[model samples]
Target chain A: MKNATITALNHAMATRQPVAFAKNLSDGTEFLLPDPHAPEALNEAGRLALAADKSTTHVLGSESWFIEARNPAPRLVLVGAVHIAQALAPLASMSGFEVILIDPRQGFGNQERFPGANLVNDWPDEALNQLKPDMRTAVVTLTHDPKLDDPALDRALHSNAFYIGALGSRKTHAARLERLSALGHQAESLQRIRGPVGLDIGSVTTPEIALSIIAEIVAVRRGGSLGLRVK
Target chain B: MIDVEDVLSIAASWHGAGEQVAIATVTETWGSSPRPAGSRMAVTTSGKMAGSVSGGCIEGAVAETAQQVMASGVPKLLSFGVTNERAWEVGLACGGKVQVFVEPLI
Candidate 1:
């Protein structure tokens, strides 16, 4: 690898931006794609690689270039350090998400409660403001408290977070929606919230509920449809 | 979920130390391939290897090809799967085919 290529790759990796490394096998020429100054063909190749989230080889005439894409790790942000969160955090982490648990209450956000998990003991709104959820992020509010969950939902809805889910019963969600509507959120924007959060798995336990939530998040992330489950 | 940066850094350091290095990347796969596309493995001229291309099912063959790439300075696009008679010998009996591109780091 040349110094320029290595430097560009290092910068992209550090900044968590998606980039593609392209190499011409025939000529031993290598360069980083998406370079504004590069040829249009190469930039298109980079876009294809990033969109597919896979490495590909493109043959242009007699020239063959291999493009390898490097994408930042996905993130899952939970707005509550409750029991279901304790189960969901590790599950999401194992599923390749950088899990973050936020709660203002020290008793619930302690290390003992969430072993090997990243805990943010600040207020939910403040924590979310600092985090600034992006397209690769999934936000779930499990606190069920208006003070905690509502603020987090507001922040998540305003950001580019791919998935936003809130935990509550249908009646609770209706009341919550009324409150958010009063706060100036449009019905279309509020519809993004997957209230009653999770698939209809008939979950009665904390772990089961957590599983359904994680499953729903994965389904949404991978562009899978939420089909009705057979009994 | 192996970090691609780690593999690239290791390959760069090996090349900086004057050790010939080759990188084998999973370019494509069919059926139930364990590793996805873009998975990589770095191998040195001294037979030391890092990362994985096929989850231990075909590392030996890849490492051998990497050594050949290092010696010849030529890239090789190798394919392995259950259709080959040697697939059973190499433990790729899971009915998947993987295409690996082995190139020397120059």
Candidate 2:
């Protein structure tokens, strides 16, 4: 039954148009139009069909279709342009992500310091306005300063950004929560945050810390808790 | 402009399209070179390519070698030495040595 659905979807996607499955070879053939707003299963069919036949298939609105075909390159937005961010940005960029480094501190968030990076020297709220954080966005705040880190976390927790983490020690994280709570951020939203963010891999140096943070983000995005430790 | 990944993607794309392509890579470099070794330029039997192995100094020579490899269906390594006094004639400005691997990509 599942295979049938997938096959039907594939058939639809291939025509570069939409297609319908003959519930039975007896029901007669029907070509269904693909819904642009269809679910993943439906879109998967559309993509599979396109891949199958290169000829005899005329794609309509191909410009729009190609635009849709280009998957949104997920962004790993770092709110602090610190050393860890400097290292993490390049590594993430190489891994096929559009990395954005935002810091209001001019000295830290300049192009010279992070060549090939989309550097934004603006406050988190203002930056988030221009670069909207959707579910595809993963945000990490490493300012280590409450003033800089808190506002970013506030905005991130409310946005659809998938991964939201803040860097600091346990004590600092606790203090940060108090500040957020005082600012009226809901506890449930705060719960979504990964504090002292990163895999529990005794990371002490700047690079190691960056690795741990990146690993944790990957774990969350993959929908796995591989780094969780049993006390 | 052909960036590093764009070059790699073109190579992969050509291979996927079932074209015979040879990739010549500069694995090392020295002295006032525009591109380092490990830089790659791919040449297809039909003469389409992405990337550059040398700063354009030895590209013609490499292109010739690439065509030979495609015709013969064999991969080989070719090198150019800029240390030779007449190296400037070939295109190397400062004395440098470049190792190029010409292999038919599957």
Candidate 3:
């Protein structure tokens, strides 16, 4: 029987057909395919097909695309090279995200602070024209200046960016919202903004605020609940 | 070549090599988990795995399951509840239930 099974496995490997239930050891467990006497036995294309068949499309809580959804790493565009942004760009890069830092304030957006980041010192809209935020992208405004933040927010609201945030206190956020509303942005459009961004971890320092904001963006991207951090 | 695509390519390469690999993903979270949903960790047949499922809370159990999946060829869904003692033992201190999907890569 073992010999027959082995022979069948060999035939299957050669034919690129899936080997039948040689075994179903356990649920959620990994199993090795038996080696077949074929050149392609070790590099079975059929196995990949089978694995893909078994792979499930799990939607994550993050608003951004799932890890399995795309062929490329998505971009996280930070409009403002603030102290917090200096901390954030590196963090995002290490976490497998492409980080782009934009600021019209040339001195602030220089390489000294945003090393290894795609630095754009143009105004937000003009810079964003090149960056091209997509649905798979995440956008954050750390500039805090209304002139810089507003145009970027306006364009982002119209774009496909999954996570959009603006930095400021609650009062500042309220005022920003009022301005956006006056400009004809609907309630839902304004809702997309994660203003006064980041999780409420009582972050007061640049690094701390950076952590809080990054955590919140991650949470939104993952579809995870804001939970105690928000409250 | 050492870009984000490279990381995913490495993952796909392992999957194609007939290695039993389990992708542990963070599907949802409540409080503070180090890694969130959509974060992937691939486990090799010999009991090594990549990616974080939930900080460090569920790594041990997930790793054990990953080895089994590599050996067994079955996919399983696991959930860790934050309130459970095992949660603390597993590292779900944030009181969130993280759903992990463990499947053999190939």
Candidate 4:
């Protein structure tokens, strides 16, 4: 709780970086790992704490140290504020994501459609450029329009966004891939986009589809597998 | 995220005001613990507290233990569970065990 530690923690939260606080139980000595992304600066215990992404106690040479990880809030960027997005945004917010909805259409991106969510009234490409998706961010194109979804997908695929999903039928996804390939995107890069977004849940309603999408996003974020569900 | 910010900020303010402060974190959990391992609670010498280690199941015990830790300047690892028979009295009726580490923030 020192002033320097508080300042560094505030800075890390503001800048969306990961930090860890290590306290030696024996002497009450404290050290702050302000940058978990910089592996070269961390010791073995620090690296383990960062990889675990959890607060834990480790003992080394008769000294016990408690390492607490302070990670920035995860973020979700939804392109094309449609009905499914309206349903997904609140759910994502509840699941600890800073949700942002982007659309050029005023009617779709208005407060009425996305209440209690950050609405970006700009084109997908422009919005994404300013956002600059990182490793803690997930981008989903709920807008089936190729004009909107394609641009956003192009931006997300290139960035370090952890998850990229697009809503469409299998046939539509095939055509979408073809378009991106023609525009010089590699096959490996295009594979990062989870077309026909969301888990196969036999969804029909907007909320159901939103649930599936959120489930898939969580699975991808937590490094869980999308194995087949047995009857 | 808000919970973490609230706990840390309260701890910082208490320390700034020259009060002894201690933080108790849920280091491990077994079975159906309400809060996860990283859950934190901050306490001061004046008995003021922020955040929670469990869902009101063992906050009182942890807070009381935190005061002792702040006074003695020694960290304590306390555990509570249904198997110990005090779980019912402490309200951890969810059939789980939790280990909390209370340490002074100097």
Q: Determine the TM-score of chain B of model 4.
A: 0.85
Model 1, clash count? 0
**Residues B1-106, model 1: lDDT tens digits:** 3354477777878888988888888877788888887788999988878889887879999999999988998888888877756666766566788888888877
lDDT of each: 0.84, 0.67, 0.65, 0.82
Clashing pairs in 1: none
TM-score of each: 0.76, 0.55, 0.54, 0.76
lDDT (tens digit, per residue) of candidate 4 on B21-82:
99888877788888887688999888788899988969999999998988887888888877
Chain A (alone) TM-scores for all candidate structures: 0.82, 0.70, 0.68, 0.83
lDDT of 1 at A36: 85
Candidate 2's residue-wise lDDT over A1-231, tens digit each?
122333444443434332422111111112222445444454554466434411111133221111012224568989989999887987777655678888999999888888878889899878877787887689899889887888888888779998888888889998999999998988888877788788888998988888888787767766677645333
- The regions of model 2 sitting more than 4 angstroms off are A1-44, A47-70, A227-231, B1-8, B12-106
Candidate 3 per-residue lDDT over residues A18-49, each given as its tens digit: 44221221322212243363224322432542
Q: Ignoring the other chain, what TM-score does chain B have in each prediction? A: 0.85, 0.81, 0.72, 0.85
- Cα lDDT tens digits for candidate 1, A98-201: 88899999988999988877889998889999999998899999988999999999999899999999999999999999999998999999988988899988
Report, to 2 decimal places, the DockQ of model 3. 0.14
Candidate 4 residue lDDT tens string, A51-165: 7777777777777776777788889999988888878988887787889899999988898766667889999999999999999899999888999999999999889999999
- The Cα error of candidate 4 at residue A175, in Å, is 3.3
Model 3: lDDT to the true structure? 0.65
DockQ, structure candidate 4 = 0.36
